[model samples]
Target chain A: MQLTGGQILCESLIREGVDVVFGLPGGAILPLYGTLPQYKDRIRHILVRHEQGAAMAADGYARATGKVGVCWATSGPGATNLVTGLACSSMDSVPIVAITGQVARPTIGKDAFQEIDVTGVTLPITKHNYLVMHASEIARTIREAFYIASSGRPGVVLVDIPRDVFQEKAEFGEYPTTVDLPGYKPVLDGNISQILRAARLIKEAQRPVVLAGHGVLLSRAMDELREFAEKTQTPVITTLLGLSGFPQTHYLSLGMPGMHGVAWASLALDEADLIIGLGARFDDRVTGDLKRFAPNAKIIHVDVDPSEIGKSVATAVPIVGDLKRVLKQLIANVEPAIHVEWMAHLDQLRREHPSLYIRPTEKLLPQYVIREISEVTDGRAVIVTGVGQHQMWTALHYTFKEPYTMITSGGLGAMGFEVPAAMGAQVGVPDRVVWSIAGDGGFQMTMSELATIAENNIPVKFAIINNNFLGMVRQWQEFFYNREYSASGYTKNPDFVKLAEAFGILGLRVTERSQVRDAIIKAMEWAGPVVVDFVVEEEENVYPMIPAGTSVDQLIEEPQMVEERR
Target chain B: MPKGPASHTIVALVQDRPGVLNRVASMFRRRGYNIVSLSVGHSEQPGFSRMTFVVNGDDHTIEQVRNQLDRLIDVVKVSDLSDENVVARELALIKVQATPYNRSEIIQLVDIFRANIVDVSPDSLIIEVTGDEDKVDSLLQLLKSFGVRELMRTGRVAMLRGANAYPGTPSANGNQ
Candidate 1:
């Protein structure tokens, strides 16, 4: 079919099974917008107030649906604005395709108005990129972009299309829409010998532990991981990124093991005889004082990316394959071994150093707010969170029973992610409840997305933990920087309830702890999006922090004691 | 570990340009990969060059050096030819001081190895030998006995067996 570049792009996206697009239109993308009306029924276009929100929305959609989320933007600032969100996606291994409109071909390289070298800027961040100078290449480039975005070690892919190309007519043929990367094969089947050796190690070890990471969720191998753990009676320790790999309520499940992780979980890692790492990178945060991390364990690392296997901690048995496939193979080959003594030891430690949560008093506690919200929603709603105190509280308190039910910026720790991401998640699963748990500081960063929520009528509930400070940074300053509070505290701030009301959305403010549940219920009952600002106690810190360069055993249990009393 | 004189195969895909071969050889000279034999040629794709080299070192150590070379970003892909399926050939211009007695011996040796005398200037013979790395090394050893004056050998160029599949091809979207 002979069609314009814009029409070709739309057709190719349709063929790729793209049902939704999150973006804002500009002059450079006017041609593409011109063709959007015809395909409105096939593609639901969610117009965001800012380009940043659009990119983050796409990120949220990708994280939730495991599909290559697509977003479009115009030239210059429009393309540059998507950089933060794209970097966030790249860091988190989210598959996103960002399409940006460029100035006319003739005006390129001449310092044309509203023009920027987006491809050059995004090279380091994206998996691959293309600049479509010719209109004929539009369909092929879009197809390739989606393919690249969703492939091995998935990341963002960008396609910069000039405005002139979009306006031009071209012979658009349905080219084979598949990528053939010879050097990009992700090994899914592990070597049988290696698996047997690892299984033998597991069986012979006195105290073995399974340290599962995000890879288990990515491979959808939670069932296999659970079976292996239960059959062998080995306790499971998860990294921060691997939080949802196992249910926190499970008998063998030791929650997140690292800085800010429970003391018992970190100690269990130190005491294990054999450490089985699945799809988890040994980040410095996770392996505090690397020299002492899991010193007694013979590490067995299984990951899809070969580079990650022996990059940080050396592995005794390195299985380079998909975690899901490899776990299934191990379960089939290895006989279950009883570790009754080990289970008893872990249980004793759990009882000794339990995960302690203080009940809410007259002033609202963030942990109580998250727990109440989780209970009220029946643990079925998709919860998104921004980084800092609220994010940690959500991870530590909220119990997510299903995979992908909780989406947060785990790798990048980008502020202002939750609200826009929740908006995107709501778009992806409209009937399901979606909540954005955010800190006051992080919430205000991209709170403009409230307009996006109101405009689109997205029924997203926002729970703002309003402690008038950058809680995480302030915690660090309080403990590590002699309690010298710089610009961390926000003495003056806009009333979130008024702000939400001004955006034509429902709003609720809960100052006292007793009002939390009622406020949340009222906000959730709103026809459109609603924001609930819960006034939390200031100077609250996430405990069990392993100070820098210290071993996991040397954790600061109570920050106040470490800072002042000690 | 004690190092052994093991053979090393260095394959490089370079941008086709003037003096690129000289620049690469100088790099080898500075870094110390004992080049036993070398070959170079234009690839199937235009304006791109492929070069191969045979060096003497431990296989693992040589692979580590090749990994460093591969990190150069300009050098597309590097493979140890010792373990890979490859075709290696070299062209050496040997300006040996040939006399009447030694002339027949050199000619006979060239004929045995299927090497062609592309240029015979009465005083010297430019022999082009196309074969595996061992064959090239043998020819070079035999030519050295003739008191060679000047030698120019093209490095190796190789493609994997069975198919010509490039990385990041459009059809590589099967997993997705």
Candidate 2:
């Protein structure tokens, strides 16, 4: 069929089975947007207020559906704005394809009106990128982009299309049935010997713990992981991105294990005879000090990315393959072993150093707010959180039964990720409820999306945990910097209720402890994008923090000076 | 990270495509991998480019740099040649500040190293030298005592001496 670059891009996206696109149109990207009407029946384009939100929305959608989420932006600033979202996705291995418009070929490097070397700028951050100089390359590039974005260890792929190229005529051909990337062949299955070795290690391990990660969800191997854990009777410790990868309420599930992880999980990691790391990188956040992390463990690391196999720690067994396939192979070859002593020790520790909640207080606390939301949603709502105290509160409190239900910026820890991601989640899973939990500082970072929510009528419920301070950073300052409080507290702030109201969305505020549930209930019920102002305690801290550069064992249970003052 | 900057020669085969070289170079620059020197050319394969780079970094940084390099889809394979017994050479054109008074001494020095004087001007002699990095560094160090005008090195290209890493290896020397 005869088609221009614009038509070809739209048709190619539809051919690739893309149902939704999140983006804001600009001058260079107008041609593609012009062709949107022709394919509107097959594709839905959500107009985000900012390109960053669009990119993040795509990321959210990808996280929820395991598809390559697509976003569009124009040249220069629009392209650069997607950098954060691209980097965030790359860090966390979420597959997203961000299409940006470029200046006409002739003026690309001449610093024309809206031209920047976006492909060059995004080189390090993206999984891969291409700048389309010809219209003929559009279809193949889109196919390749989606293929690259969704394959093993998925990541963001960007394609920059020139404006003139978008207007050029080309022949639209059939979509390639398979990717022709010879250089990108990821190992899909572990060697039999390695799988057998892993099984032997599991059977012999007296104090074994399975360190699960995002790869398990990425591979859709939750069942395999659960069965493997069940067959072996091993306690599972989840990384930040690995949350919801396992049923957190299961008997062997030891919530999150890292810097701010559950005390028992970290302790298990410290004392384990064998650490079976499944698709989890030994990220700095997960291992506070590398030298002291899992000192007693004979490590077995399995991941599709060969680079991550022995990058951080020396391992006894390194199996570089897809987590799903490796776990499946091991399940067939392995014998189930129960380490009663290990489970008992972990249970005893968990009971001894139980997670504490705020004592009965008149002031509405942040933890209570998150707990109440978890209680109401009950694994039905897809929870997205922005980075800060609220994010930790959500991770520690929420019990997500299914995989990929909790989407936060685990690797990059980017602020302002919640609203747009929640929008994408809601759009992807319209039948399910979507909640965006943001800190006061982070909520304002991308709150411009409130207009997007109102414009799209996205029906996303937002909970702004308003503490009037950058709570996390302030907590750090209070503990380490002698409480000088440099630029941590807000000198002035917008009233969130009024702000949401201004965007033409339902707005409510809960100032006292008694109003928490009712306010959340009101927002959940009145949902055409409702924002709840949760005015939480001004001075709250996420406790059991492993101070930076220290071992996991040396955690500060409570803020010293603050507790003394109290 | 180690105590001092460690130099490593990394050879990589990459898909020959538009902006691929820029992609590889930009990755190094962005990730703070200091490229001491680099050279690239078409390989034996029609659609592949072979790149050899001399990077200076600590142990940890270099490992990460190599990992990041290999992660790019264009990169077919990355091999670090630091510990391998290999044939390595670098070409350098050093124009030395030689005069009538010291021309003979410079000629002797060049002759001792078996370097060729490619061009001789009124006040300077351009000497072309090829050898390993240590020998190249020694000649340059020797020239430093004299008035060395300018120098340029084509960086280093290397191959395993006896046999390739595997059959029909992309690391073969047919492209050279």
Prediction 2 global C-alpha lDDT: 0.86
Docking class of 2: acceptable
How close is every model to the real structure, measured as TM-score?
Answer: 0.81, 0.94
Q: Measured against the native two-chain assembly using Cα atoms, what DockQ does each of the candidate structures obtain, in the order listed?
A: 0.06, 0.34
Candidate 2 residue pairs that clash: none
Query: Which prediction has the highest TM-score against the true structure?
Result: 2
Indicate the residue-level lDDT of A467 in model 2.
Answer: 92
Q: Could you give candidate 2's per-residue lDDT for residues A1-566 as a string of tens digits?
A: 88999999988898889999998888898888888899889999888889999999999999988888999899999999998988999999999999999998888789999889998888888889999999998999999998888887899899999998999999987867787886787778887777878888888899999999999999999999999999999999998889899998899999887767778888889999999999999898888889888888999999888778667887788887889998999899888888888899999998887454455777788989988998888865789999988998888888888787899998899999998898898888887788898889988889988888899898999999999999999888887788878999997989888889899998888898888888878888885889998888987888667777777658656556345533
Candidate 1: C-alpha lDDT: 0.79
Model 2, position A253, has a per-residue lDDT of: 97
Best by DockQ: 2
Which regions of candidate 2 are displaced past 4 Å? Answer: A559-566, B1-7, B56-63, B97-112, B138-146, B162-176
The Cα error of candidate 1 at residue A370, in Å, is: 1.6
